[model samples]
Target: MASYQMLVKDVIKRADILLEVIDARFPDETRNNEVERDVARSKKPLIIVLNKCDLVSKEKLEETKSRLSKIAPTVFVSGKNRFGTTMLRHKILETAGIKGREILVGSLGYPNTGKSSVINGVAGKHKTGTSPISGYTKVLQLVNAGSRIMFIDTPGVIPFGENDEYIQGLLSVKDATSLKDPIGVAMKIIEKLCAENKTALESFYHITIGGQDSYDALILIGKQCNFLKKKGEVDDTRAAVRIINDWQKGLLVI
Candidate 1:
């Protein structure tokens, strides 16, 4: 983690402008406040990119853009759908101007926030290695964003905060595939959805949670999704993992 922090610091120091990629679903959770501070201190223009906009509603996207614009130049994009990345590219090109040289543009974000996807989306042909697992791109790589722009892809930056395992799992910093208590962590995701918007969760999963708690709702979803174990038993762990996967992959609507 220390080495990753140092690398991020180096990237910030070297780049002319920084594009901080944040998750549209949970912008605050995915943002690296420390890196933003460093960017501010360095006096470089920072662009806050709300990635995975396809996972969110149009109204929600507007709300987030409006709210985040006050902090920095904000753009909402989805690498998965290849939407709004052109705007990101134009922003980078415009910011760097028509200089006859390479402009360093670095992307930094937490795991599963589509940083690599966004980079690859904008690069068009020069794609980077993107994966569902966290910390997949371990080293920094420079890919050309056309002829004038040099886009730098760095390792996912997970700042030190929120020690709660539940929050970590919720943000996808925790490895759900190897979690010791998948059901427990999965409950956190179900409970969060229920608390935030029970209707969306129930509607997406096609389950009813009327008068029932998160666990009950989860049980219904497990059966509905056919996550069954031996002897007709509900595979709570598998269901939990699927829920996490759904949320991470932006299948679950807010």
Candidate 2:
């Protein structure tokens, strides 16, 4: 954790501008407030790049953009579908407000937030390697983004002692098999889906959530999938893992 903090601070000091890449579905949760404060202290222009916009709805994106714009110049980007990359490029130059000399842009975000994908999208090529697993970028690499803009791609930043299983599970920072409390995390995911998009959750699981809380919904899903134990009881752990896997894979949208 200390190493990550040092890496992020070093990148922030070296770069001309900074891009805080966050998950578009859970912008608030994925954002690193401490890093933002460091960027603030350094007085560097920070652009909030909301990646994975394709996984979220337009209305939600607009709402998130409006709220986050108050803090920094926010841009919605879908690195998967190559959407909003042009807007992101324009926004980066517009935020920097400099020309002639190359602009060193530093990218920061939590694990699995699509920092590499965003970089690739903006560069219009696969300049940096990307993976679905978290903490894939181990070292900082500089890539030419053209237009007098260069990118300093840094590793994902997570604060020290940030061991919340639910946040990690939701952000794909930890895979379903990696989590110790998969059932608890899946219940939280169900509650979030129930609150935000119950219809999508129901449709994806093929179960009616009428009056059923997160636990009941989980059991029902297990029953439907025939994930059962010796006594025909629902195998909750397997069901929970399935739910988390589906959520991380973008199959269950909220």
For residues 177-199, could you state the per-residue lDDT of candidate 2 as single tens digits? 99989999999999988977888
Q: Give TM-scores for every candidate, taking all chains together and pairing residue i with residue i.
A: 0.80, 0.91
lDDT values for all models: 0.77, 0.86
The parts of candidate 2 lying over 4 Å away from their true place are 125-138, 159-162
Q: Model 1, poorest ten-residue lDDT window?
A: 128-137
Q: Which candidate leads in TM-score?
A: 2
Across residues 1-254, which tens digit of lDDT does each residue of candidate 1 receive?
A: 57667777778876888899987877767777788898899888889999888877787788889998898989999988889988998888776564878787878877667787898888886443332322333556777767566777776665545455655676677778866677787787787677666788988988878877766777788999998988898887778888877876657776
167, model 2: CA deviation in Å? 2.3
